[model samples]
Target: MLLLALLEAAGIAKLGASIGAGIAAIGAGLGIGRIGSSAMEAIARQPESTGDIRTNMIIAAGFVEGVALFAVIVCLLCLFL
Candidate 1:
């Protein structure tokens, strides 16, 4: 009985981890998309500052990706450990 309970708990943990990872990825994608869209609008308004806007957008996207990656790693760790 204890063994069965432990197996069920592990299964639940894996499911939770997968769901968390999916949420993290979706959040990151939305964040990056918004950043890109806003940057494009800003560049359209002032074409001369395109370089600066582009640079900032890339940096923001990188940060978002980094966060997403960390979340995914944590989730995977939960599944394995």
Candidate 2:
């Protein structure tokens, strides 16, 4: 991949990969945190809609986690291959 090539040329492929993975994890954490915060606020505002808010929050968190996992896997591959 072009990205790999560039990193290799710069002699920091492993470092880059590690940093990328860390960033992905941090971003996911932030995204999930925001989702939870918003969901709680929404639930507080509308107690009767707790079920809907919780469901949407979980779904959004799952999506963010999935993306983070994919990013981490890609970074690991880049580090090893």
Candidate 3:
């Protein structure tokens, strides 16, 4: 509410882009944290599968990061163009 009021008062036209980038970054961070936490739990349960768990975690993290990066880039484009 406060943010909306501020933006409205400031008459910022690119607020949507800024908000989109922020949401994407925040979502990616949360997603990566959850993936890491789960992988750690799995590894703790099965030490023998540590390698597989770590590999899968990295792959999943990479995908999340890639999507976040794309979102941020699109948001930036919207802001600039």
Candidate 4:
């Protein structure tokens, strides 16, 4: 019985981590995708604005990437803890 309880607890912990990682990816994907598409459109419409558009896009992408990275770290900690 004790072994079964231990196994169940481990399974729950793993499941929670997996879910956290998956949820984090969703926000990252949406944010990056939006920035990419908008940047492309901006460049297409005004080629001269490419430089500015790209700069802003990079900054926004970095922020999104950071959040995703944080989520990944949290997931890792949850699993190991």
Candidate 5:
């Protein structure tokens, strides 16, 4: 009975960690997708200004990727810590 109780508690802890990781990914996906779509639309509307648009898009994409990486790192820390 004691062993079963311990296992149940561990299972609950793991579930929380799993949920945290999943939420982080979802948030990152939404943010990155929004940045990408906006960049694409801007480029489509102004082909002549493609150079400037592409530069900004690359910068924005990098920011998005950085944030996502940070979230993932935090998630991993939470799981391990």
Candidate 6:
């Protein structure tokens, strides 16, 4: 009985980790999409500041991706430990 319970708990942990990783990926995608859209709009409105806008957009997107990566790693850790 105890062994069965342990297996069930491990399964549940793996499932939760997978779900969490998926959610993190989705969130990062949405965030980067929004940043890109906004940056394009800003560049269109002020063509002369294109360089600045692009740089800022890339920085923001990088930050979002980093955070998402961290979240995924944490979730994966949950599955293993």
What TM-score would each prediction reach against the true structure?
0.88, 0.89, 0.85, 0.79, 0.70, 0.87
lDDT of 5 by residue, 1-81 (tens): 776457556776456666777877787778878877887898899889888987887797788778877877776765665
Computed on alpha carbons, the lDDT of every model, listed in order, comes to: 0.92, 0.94, 0.91, 0.89, 0.75, 0.92
> Considering summed lDDT, which 10 consecutive residues are worst modelled in model 3?
4-13
List, residue by residue over 31-61, the lDDT tens digit for candidate 6.
Answer: 9999999999999999999999999999999
C-alpha displacement of 79 in model 4, angstroms?
Answer: 1.1
lDDT of 5 at 78: 53
- Best lDDT among the predictions, by candidate number: 2
28: Cα error in model 2, Å: 0.3
Query: Best by TM-score, which number?
Result: 2
Clashing pairs in 2: none
- Native RMSD of candidate 3 (Å): 5.4
TM accuracy, model 3: 0.85
Model 3 per-residue lDDT at 42: 100
Backbone-clash count (model 4):
0
10-78 in candidate 1: lDDT tens per residue?
688788889999999999999999999999999999999999999999999999999999999999987
Pairs of colliding residues, candidate 4: none
Counted clashes in each candidate structure: 0, 0, 0, 0, 0, 0
Clashing residue pairs for model 5: none
User: Which wins on lDDT, candidate 2 or candidate 4?
Assistant: 2
Cα lDDT of model 3 by residue, 1-81, tens digit: 778567656757388889999999999999999999999999999999999999999999999999999999998886775
Clashing pairs for model 6 are: none
Q: Count clashing pairs, candidate 3.
A: 0
Considering summed lDDT, which 10 consecutive residues are worst modelled in model 5? 4-13
Query: On a 0 to 100 scale, what is the lDDT of residue 35 in model 4?
Result: 94
Give the Å error, residue 44, model 5: 1.9
